[model samples]
Target: MLVKMYYNIKIIIFKLACFKLALPADGATGEHEDTSQPRQVTSTRRTQVSVRGPDSPKIRGEVHAPIRGLKCLCTNAHSMGNKQEELALLLADTNPDIVGLTETWWESTHDWAVNIKGYRLFRWDRKGRKGRGVAPYVKKQYTSLPNSVGSEDGQTEMLWVRIQGGQGQRDLMVGVYYQLPNQGEELDWEFSGQLVETVKSRDVVIMGDLNYPDNCWEEQSARSDRSHRFLAEIQDLYLTQEVHSPTRANALLDLVLATGNDLVRGLQVLDHLGDSDHCLLEFTIQLRVSKACSKAAALDFRRADFNELRRLVGEALRSQRVRELRI
Candidate 1:
């Protein structure tokens, strides 16, 4: 049995040697030779990337400018009543200096809930109406006051605020406007008049839902007469629309219009606030604002010496007792 096993192993080794001798050498041209070059093995690991969506805000050319100026946010809330918490979250996340909201659907009754902590609210609600309203919230540090520069006797849903700028800078005129869809020509003219008056200022920023879907901001043209008029008005006033992304659906309804070319730096269209279909608009204004100073004084306990304080108190008590004994 051992001899038979050795014979079988020797036969297997002989076959293996015959097969190795029959194989072709490297670079030998034969029917089994491989003539193609070796393929490069690329890395299978993926690189992290961020892709901006179709509804993402168009980054303006002034992105490289100084980012130390005022940070502002605007959104057509559709109705701000139920979205205050969401807005508050957005406020905390963005830490904007100014916030403008259109179609707030606010009434005098909403005064109780409209005030946001660290921000002063200024609003213009449609008289006797429930749907249309505009509100602007300025940080508590900024000295902001309601103005009538861009309002037409409550005819249009608009609110204006004069924000005090830093030293050596003029006050910024900020307006929040909400143009009603399919409104009368008179209302359009009134809103246009408001823009005309507001644009007269050197520093002006107007933002809201204009509702002119036919106007293409990229081409700077409009098919409808109303959009054409608005486009023409913007051109005439030398106002630049910094928001290029679609705020509502496929249309660019929300806008951040600045009077001068340099007044706007960057604008971003963020996610919808709460359940509102319209997206949020975040932008930066090219003006420096004075920092808010705190009036309350705080005691510093970190550097305090409890032993020294007790010694001083005992000395004062002893001195008082000595004086009392003398008296």
Candidate 2:
């Protein structure tokens, strides 16, 4: 019985050994199991991506001009919309340093000033109750004068700014004015006279939608020369006429006047009148400072000094010794 049990245990052990050898090297329990080599470990890191909206456009660098200084624009503010944006883009293409908008019907609470990329804004609107007002958009890089001097009518306003020229000298002062369309002839005359007087003391460029026809004599003689006295005042002040309409018919009422003999070397009538009733006036003045005038300006000739010099010269001449010395 013991011999028979030993033989049965040996047979069982042999059967278990045979079963283990029949299995695959990976010890798979099923016939359909995958025996291919293991896939190589892929070490990948998760990355983040940034996205921009569709409306954003890439910005180009600053524009270059033959002349460097303050460039001015005068446009009547009809309203702010797609038309207005087109106008702004048009002005941006020209790259004016300063822009004066008249009849701007902007609420004091809203963003009255817009970003021209590298520009700052100085805006003044009449009281909300008041009908209309003026605003100036100046380039951010330039320095603006502290005070903007003007008349009380609110029909016209001026911006005073010291512009550094490419020659590295203070060469320009820009004054932007906007007068109402129907401000009586007397008031027109008065305002024109005031503008001329104010700008005469400085090197100025006066640009605006004066609302008076360039050919006042031809179009509205009934209003008379008094209504268009601003043009006369500008001409009388020795400010060279940089831009004036060529034909009385379909002519632009906008004007650009430059002080002294610097003639407007270039004038362009931009094709953007669809946005506003008035066409865009663009002109360039070649400013050449006179050395003699500059020297006179630098001299410290105070009123007291002038009086003393005259008195001393008179006394020295009266004295016989001084006269003899000259003789």
Candidate 3:
């Protein structure tokens, strides 16, 4: 079993780096959970109007109806270059309820730069660095709004949001991070610990360009000490990784880690936009019903009315014996 998992990881990682991971029939790195009873496949109702964007017409998948939790899209926009219009159109077409953008490379002062119609944006920008920022976009239709928790970690860019989507879902928490490459140092375990501590007692989704890879998870050590600590810190939080496909330049730097199996209804790796090196992680958030699914009760047929049947059988046998003697 261990060998099979490692083998799968190796094969998927290789394909991810090549940017070839797509479609389940094409062997994408997706292991969808199906045990939940309340989960339903998303229906794509045909529309007459034309939607603008490169990926809009191409976007097709099982998107759940937003009666519960909303659909979510995560990506690293990487400085918001020529792909801004393309990315916005893709979101507008797909109609995800929430979207997370990391490495935005835009400062908070440039609020007018981002334009996605009908959605309220929550963002945290980096002033000093040339390439650092994080934020989530919540759709207007959602009743429970999301609030920014601020970047509690100083060393790396970290962003957290409290998504209040009424009760029964327990309110979802999302943490975004951009751990820049070649920092010449290890991850601050203290700060990582604080990120985990903040999302306690809630259904959380931690998604970003984590920038740590583990071709080495099988060895109990990683390609770098950096990855080793990353795996450890997340494990301490009991968050399972939902997005395993490679996000950028064939490495699985981008990820979506959540608290339970049913939180993410679906996930896909999309083609990169314009000159961006990273692809998109398109995923959906299963509503409250899917999250709270309980197995139906069963009955044991063998335990039913056996004693009464035995008595009736004995009476029948005695009557048969008496009739045989008379004959």
Q: State which candidate has the highest lDDT.
A: 1
- TM-score (all chains, Cα) for each model: 0.66, 0.56, 0.62
For residue 216, model 3's alpha carbon misses the true position, in angstroms, by 4.8
- Whole-model Cα lDDT of every candidate shown, in order: 0.71, 0.50, 0.61
Off by over 4 Å in 3: 1-67, 143-155, 184-187, 215-221, 287-327
**What lDDT tens digits, residue by residue, belong to model 1 across residues 183-258?**
8998888888877766653478999998888888889988998889889988988988888889998988898898
lDDT of 1: 0.71
In what order do the candidates fall by TM-score, top score first? 1, 3, 2
Q: Candidate 2, after superposition: displacement of residue 300 in Å?
A: 23
Q: RMSD, each candidate, Å?
A: 33.0, 37.7, 18.2
Top candidate by TM-score: 1
lDDT tens readout by residue for model 3, 165-243: 3323334666777777756454465446556565555567778887766644334457767777677777777767787
Instruction: Tell me which residue pairs clash in candidate 3.
Output: 16-250, 17-250, 42-63, 69-287
Distance (Å) between predicted and true CA of 261, model 3?
1.9
